[model samples]
Every structure is written in C-alpha cells, then in structure tokens.
Target: MADSFSQAARAATNELRQLFEPTPLQRNDHLSAQYGAEIWLKREDLTPVRSYKLRGAFTAMAAVLAQRSDQKVFVCASAGNHAQGVAFACRHFGVTGVIFMPVTTPEQKIAKTRIFGGDNIEIRLVGDYFDDTLAASQGYCAEAGGHFLAPFDDADVILGQASVGVEILDQLGKEPDIVILPVGGGGLSAGLTRLFRETGAASSFRYVEPFGGASLTAALAHGAPETLESVDSFVDGAAVARIGALPFETLKNVAMEHVILSKEDSLCATMIDMLNVEGIVLEPAGALAINALEQIKDQVKGKTVICVTSGGNFDFERLPEVKERAQRFLGRKKYFILRLPQRPGALRDFLGLLGPHDDIARFEYLKKSARNFGSVLIGIETTSPDAFEALFSRLDNAGFVYRDITNDDTVAQFII
Candidate 1:
C-alpha cells in the first residue's frame, strides 16, 4: 500500500512540474558549518504558496474530482498555510472552494490567501478560535452536501505531500544519511516517510515539534492520538493539539527518542539567525527542524542531512515580538517587578544600579503600595548576557527587593 501510494506521489510530482518547478534543494553553508554536517535545506519555502501544503491540496482535489465529477465545491478550515494551499489548488483546477478561517487570523495571511484563490475561492471568517471554525466548516459541509477536506488526515493529502520526498531524492540523486521533518498535523512527515520506505531509501529520520504542541511525540508515547490540553499558537503552522489518525498510523513505529521538542522561544532565535545571517525569512514553524539540529549536532557531523523548511508565511509585524522572545530565551533580556521607595531620588538611585549596556525597554508602575514604596514593572535589554549578572548583583547590594518575571508565565502573560 505504501509503495503504491509513493508511486502515485511520484506521478503527481511529474504532473506538478507543469504547475511549478521543484523547490530548491540548496546547501546551507552557515547551518552546515554550525552543525559540522553537510546540511542541505529542502526549500519548500520557495514553493508557489511558500509551503508544501499546496502539493497535498492539489493532489487530493485532483484525485477526488477525477472520480467524482459532480463534486466541485470543497470546504476546509485553516487560518494559515493550509487555507492558502487549498485556495491555490482551487484556482489551479478552476473549482470553487470555501475556506473557513478563525476571525482572529492575521489580516496579512487572509489577504494572501484571497489573492491566491482569486475568484475561485470564498473566504469566510467564522469563529474566533480554530476549533470553532473547524466545527462550523464541518457543519456547513454536512448541511450543504459539499466535500470537506481534512488537511492532513486524508490519504490523498498524504500522497500529495509525499511528492516532496520524491523531489528531494531526485534532486539529490540519492538519499541523504538523515532527513529532518517538522511535525504539525503530521501530513508531511507521514507522506515523506512512506516515500522513503517505499523507494527503499535508507535515510534515518528525525521529527521535530514545538515544545508547547508535541502532539506527535505524545501520540507516539500513548500509541494513539491524544489531544493536548492546551497548545501555544506562536508556531501557528505546527500548533496542532492532536495528531491526525492516518498520520499517526504511518508514524506509529517511530522511536520516541527520534522525536525532538523545540521550545517556541528558542525557535524564535533560529528564525532570527536564519533571517539575519542567511537572509532567509522563515515562519516560527519553518525553523523547528533546523533548530532541533542543534541538539543532535554531534551525531550528524560529517553526514549529509536534509532539513525540511516547512513554510515562509511570516508577517513582518511580528518581528519585534520574535526578537524579544529570542533575546529573552538567550538570556540577553530580562523583565522584573521591582518595589522602589517613593522618594524624590528613588528613581535615580534605582537607575544607578543598571550597567552601561542595560537599556530600559519598558517601565510601568503597578501600584502605589505604601506611603514610601511603589511596585514597578520594568523590562531591560542588554548588549551581552553577562550584563545581567552584574546588574542583578548591583540591585541586590542596593537593598532593592525585585522578582524576575521573565519566566513567570502567569505574571508575564497577564502583564507583559
């Protein structure tokens, strides 16, 4: 079954060539040297939709339409890349599509998705959250007798996503020693793994997922799909609460040790690194596989490896937040709640403890607690991480009682 699916994927790849040439398989010198490995990035970010989702959407829609000629209307719920993929595919096939997105999805993303679909698709902003939107889409599909598309769970979608593996092997002329895949809904990983196994490719595999949404690893541990209680939406593309059933079936035998978890903040650091150092603009989800490589650097040394850069639907408006998260994760920034005396020279005295490298990024007085003291929220950024040690020492010596709120999730989330 896997071999037949992979063969169909290969044929789909050939058909896709007519729509868009294969995305680049380029050697990344910076990443390669940093990891001591010959790291090649399968630049799925270079795709027409700037993601591998398009392949799956196109393949599934085409296959479905071929068998069921009367099924022209397609419905899907996605606020990000998947919506764009379906939209683009609808335009390609001259079919009508209805996309349901959470009302809170970024305007930039909705605009891009609309542009891709043009007149072939309709964008509907439904519920404020993804779950609500998905339920609404499914309900609409059932009521209208329209075909509903599951982003990653359907076999045809997986077969479509397998085309990425086919292109990678063809472009490389052989399989690499390792293939790193980013896990979201698990369509891409399932598709690629099936492709590798069916083709008799000997490449080892590593799966990376956001720490807040380690659905794949959790599913692997439980031997079935398990929905997370909560998931951080920072890495929006990969923030799935539950792994799809079909995807889990393909990836069930994967060793738990091979699944890597990357922190959302740390992923921000990699995003900044790739953008500033390599001139590569990647979304948070796109950086997961590359960021995980840091943890296994020693193991991959002198080996040829491929990292799948999942998507590039990043918005520049989030750049400041990304930089802040990166700096905080690297310990170059700190947020604190300080109680200072309410005196004329109190502010000056508190400022004296800060080193020359420390810059005040944010300041807010929480409340005037007593006649002599006030609770203040302060955010400080520094040139080097060592600057924090000296600053903290000075604050201690000055007899100021302060709480580091950087990692305090409750306080940070509510106040920061």
Candidate 2:
C-alpha cells in the first residue's frame, strides 16, 4: 500500500509538473541557528496560486474530467487560495468552473481568483460565511450536474496533497528528523503522514493549529472529527471548524502530544519576525509551524526540522492589525479603559505617569458629557516587555483608576 501510494503521489506530481514547477524547499540559516536545528522550509506558498491548494485542485479536477468525459463544469467554494487553485486548474484544462465565495471574502482574493481563471471560470459571492457559501455551491453543483471539488475532504485531494511529502523527501535527499505542518481541514497533514508512513520515512510529525480553530486537537480528543462551536478566522488558511472526515481517518493516530496549538496573537509576532528578519510574508496559517517552534524549542534542538509554509495570500491592509496583535502578545503594547476625573490636569497627570519609552497609540474618551468623570480608552506601546510593569505601577501609584483591557478579549473586541 505504501509503495502504491508513493507511486500515485509521484505520478500525480509528475502530471502537475506540466502545469508549473514544484515549489522550492529552501533551508533557513536563521531559523536553524535560532533553534539549534537544521531548519528547512517547504515553500508551498510559492505555488501558482500562492498555495498548495492547486495540487489537490488539479488532481481532483483531472480525475473528474477523465472519469466523465461529458462533465464540462466544476464547482468549488472558497474564500481565497482554494478558489484561485480551482480557477487556475479550470483555465489550464479549458473547462468551465463556477466558484462560490463568501460575500465577506476580501476583494483582493476575489480579484486574484478571477484573474487566474480568466474566461474559464465564473465566481459567485453568495453568503457571508464559508458554510453558507459551501452549501450554495453544492446545491448548484447538484442542480447544474457539475462536479463539486471539495477543498480538503475528498480522497483524490488528499492523494494530490501527498505529493508535497514526496517532493520534500526527493529534494532534501534524506529524511528530516521532524516534520512540522499547519493543519486546516487535515488534508495536508493526512496526506503527508500517509506518504511518510507508506515510504517508511522516520520523520516524526508535529501538527500546529491556531488555538482558536484547533479542529485537529478536538478530533484527537473525541476519537472522531468534531465541529467546533466557534473558530477564530484570523488564521484563515488553517482555521477550519471541523477536520475533514476523509483526512481524519489517517490523522486519527496522531498523538495529542505532537499537536501544537498556537495562540492567534503570538502567531502574529512570528509573522512579523519572519517578515522583518527573514523577509517572508506569511499569512497567519503559514506562520503556525514556525510559531510552534517557540513552544517546542528544546525538543527540536540539533535535529533536522522541516516546516511546511502553507499559503502567502495575505492582504497588506491587515498589516496594522497584525502589528498591533504582535505588539500586545509581546507585552510591548497594552490597552486600558481609564476612568479620568473631569479636571484640567487629569490628562496631564495620566501622561506624566507613562514611562520614558512609552508612546500613546490610541486615546479615545468614551463619554464627553459625563458629570464628573469620563471613560477613556487608551492604547500604549512601550520599548520593552518590562516597560508595561513600570507604567502600570506608576498608574497605580498615582491613584488613577484604570482597568487593563489588554488581555480582555471581550472588552478589547468592542473598544480596541
């Protein structure tokens, strides 16, 4: 079975080569030095659609076209990379594709998908959420007699994704000591695990998921794929509410200890570090494995580690948000609701309480016409983590009433 899966992976990869060259597997000297490990990055973000989604898209679409010569239409639902992948594949195969995207999807993504598909695909902005868009697409697929290409659930898609593992082994010319993969629907993790298992490669696996959407962790705990009550969509590429049933079959054996849940805000710091230090623009999902390195620093020391950098379809518009999140996670920034007395020197007193390196980023008075006091929302950025301690101490010493909403997600959600 391993041999056959290996062959299938190779064949699928070979077929894909006709469309575009394989994504590079580059060694990172900086990460290697930092972790005391030989770190390699499987640069799947460099794909034609800027994601690994294309491999699955092509493999699934090709199988459908081969099996049913009469089927000329394909349908899929995605807010980003997956949609672009299907679009590119549809154009490559000269087939018509209808892509359904959530109305809330960024315009940059929708435009890129359109550009990739050109005349071969039509896009529909239907629902506000992915589930709604998926339902609409499936309904259309059924009504129009078009083939539906699942983003990660299908067997063919998993097989296609396995090719990444094959490429890694071939490129590195040796088995990596550790393979760190970011999990979304479990397709990539499932495919890679199967490939390694079949090939008998001795690389241990570490799965990383954004803490808000730890579908893989939930599944492993429940012994089956379970739907999450809510998923933070910040890590859009790997933020699935549920793991795919087909993918979970292979991933069922994954040890909970091997799974790493990355905090959404901390992941932003990793992104910033990569961008500033490595000049890599990683979307939140793409930063997962790298961010997990923070939690497992001791385990990977002096080992050969491979981090699969997934998707790079990030909007520059979100850079400020990412920066803010990163700063807060690093303790270099804080937000608070200060109750300021309605007096002339109150603002000056609060300003005087700030340390030398502290900078005011946001100052919004919630109530202008209060009788005696006003609720002031404030955001402060400091030079170092310890700077927050000094500033907070000063605030307390000065007897100014303030509520730190820095770690308060509920309060931060509304004001920050």
- Candidate 2: Cα lDDT at 371: 83
Residue runs of model 2 more than 4 Å from their true location after superposition = 1-3
Task: Estimate the overall C-alpha local distance difference test score of candidate 1.
Answer: 0.93
The TM-score of candidate 1 is 0.97
lDDT of 1 by residue, 120-154 (tens): 99999999889999999999999878888889999
Per-residue lDDT over 281-367 for candidate 2, one digit per residue giving the tens place of the 0 to 100 score? 889998898898879999999999999999888899999999999999999999989999998999998888888899999999899
On a 0 to 1 TM-score scale, where does candidate 2 land against the true structure?
A: 0.97
Root-mean-square deviation of every model: 1.5, 1.4
Q: lDDT of all predictions, in order shown?
A: 0.93, 0.92
